[model samples]
Target: MAKAIRQIKQVDPAPEEWQAASLSAVVKAAAENGESLIKLLEIIKQLDGMGVLNAMEGLLQNRVDVAEIALGQLNQPTMYHVVKNGMNVFKFLGAIDPEQLQTILSGITSGFEKAAQSGGQESLWKLGKSMRSPEVKRSLAMMTGILAGMGEAMEQNHSLPEGGTDIG
Candidate 1:
């Protein structure tokens, strides 16, 4: 069955109604988050006293041009790469469990500390001896497996993987 169509009409706010609504909103906001709002206003007052607020106001007055200039700057290759890598990092981090990531990161830090304590760099003979340790053997196997998986994923995606680049 087809539903009957009803014509919609727009209603403009009358001055009294708008005033009442605005005042009600202020009251509701104060009631809901009065402490936080007061703290924010106090921070603003401090900024105003320090002349920072007026500087911000002046910048905002020319917001359109400022935004245009910012957009133009962001259009540059370095800025583009910065934004792209930031987004990629966020995406990569999003896929991992926080606890698991912390564990792996701590393990890496521990490995570095242990390596530094032994010597700056091991001799080829020492490296050969170290490689025979079960722990070292296991780590190498795990690292190679992870690299293989990443290489396969890169091949499937057919896109060159990003290397960390800093322009900031």
Candidate 2:
């Protein structure tokens, strides 16, 4: 017990000693992560070149005013609607099947290319023939089905969970 107390008394560090210890630890860490340090320095250099550092410094200088402005903006109805719509869009995206969505996007791209290549207005008979195309009929069916489902969903009454916030 006496030896333990003696060791603790002997090791009581000054402020400068603490600072030196921290610097030594940091130096050791930098040596161990030299590659990571290089990459971090490169990222910092790019940010500085982009004037992001200056922008950050300015933001820090006027942090209180910036925060107040941000808070005021968030309180506005326009901001609220923007946030709500963004959230709903994200929710809708999450609900979609990614593979199916990709296929639909590919189809749209093909349609655009075909339209560009055609480069002219279609005759009345050609327009009527398009209605008989399997792809067109399939797309119309899918679109109508989606619209009907959405209409039904809109008409249905929904209840939120006990702790859930009102989405509206």
Candidate 3:
């Protein structure tokens, strides 16, 4: 048996040696993932060719100014309303059934085509008679229903004076 060890000395690696070791590990990993490394290189080449890399580098260098400009634009009341209206539009669209919306759009397209073909000179009597048709009745019902629903939503969501003032 050997005598008990008095001290343990740890030798720190030189900077160059440490760098070489790290590079060797990276090389080994790149070898192991040759296909992925090639694909990544290809993407980098394409981005560089398109000047996207340059743009990104510039953006990174001036990120503080870019952020300030963006924040200033978004801080406006108009921007606030725009963002709010966009969200409401998205919500409204999401609430509708896609198939029902498609049907409605198709009907509107067909109606427009028919109206165009009619030369817009139909007499009031003819228009009144057309209202008796099932298609016209169906469309009118849909419009009135939409109006009623919109009225209900307005009443529920807004606290307007007797005759509403247009804030828009």
| Leading candidate by TM-score | 2
C-alpha lDDT of all candidate models, in order: 0.88, 0.88, 0.94
The sequence of per-residue lDDT tens digits that candidate 3 reaches over residues 16-74 is 99999999999999999999999999999999999999999999999999999999999
Q: Please report, as a residue range, the 10-residue window in candidate 1 with the lowest summed lDDT.
A: 159-168
Q: State model 3's lDDT.
A: 0.94
Please give the RMSD to the true structure for each candidate, in Å.
9.7, 7.8, 4.8
What would the per-residue lDDT of candidate 1 be over residues 1-168, giving only the tens digit for each residue?
998879878899999999999999989989999899989999999999999989999999999999999999989999989999999999999999999899879879999999889877778999899999998987899898987788778768875446522224
Q: Score residue 149 of candidate 3 by CA lDDT.
A: 81
**Residue 96 in model 2: lDDT:** 93
Best by lDDT: 3
Per-model TM-score, in order, reads 0.59, 0.73, 0.69
* lDDT head-to-head 2 vs 3, winner: 3
Model 3 alpha-carbon drift over 4 Å, by segment: 1-17, 109-129, 157-168
Model 1 ranges off by over 4 Å: 1-42, 49-51, 119-121, 158-168
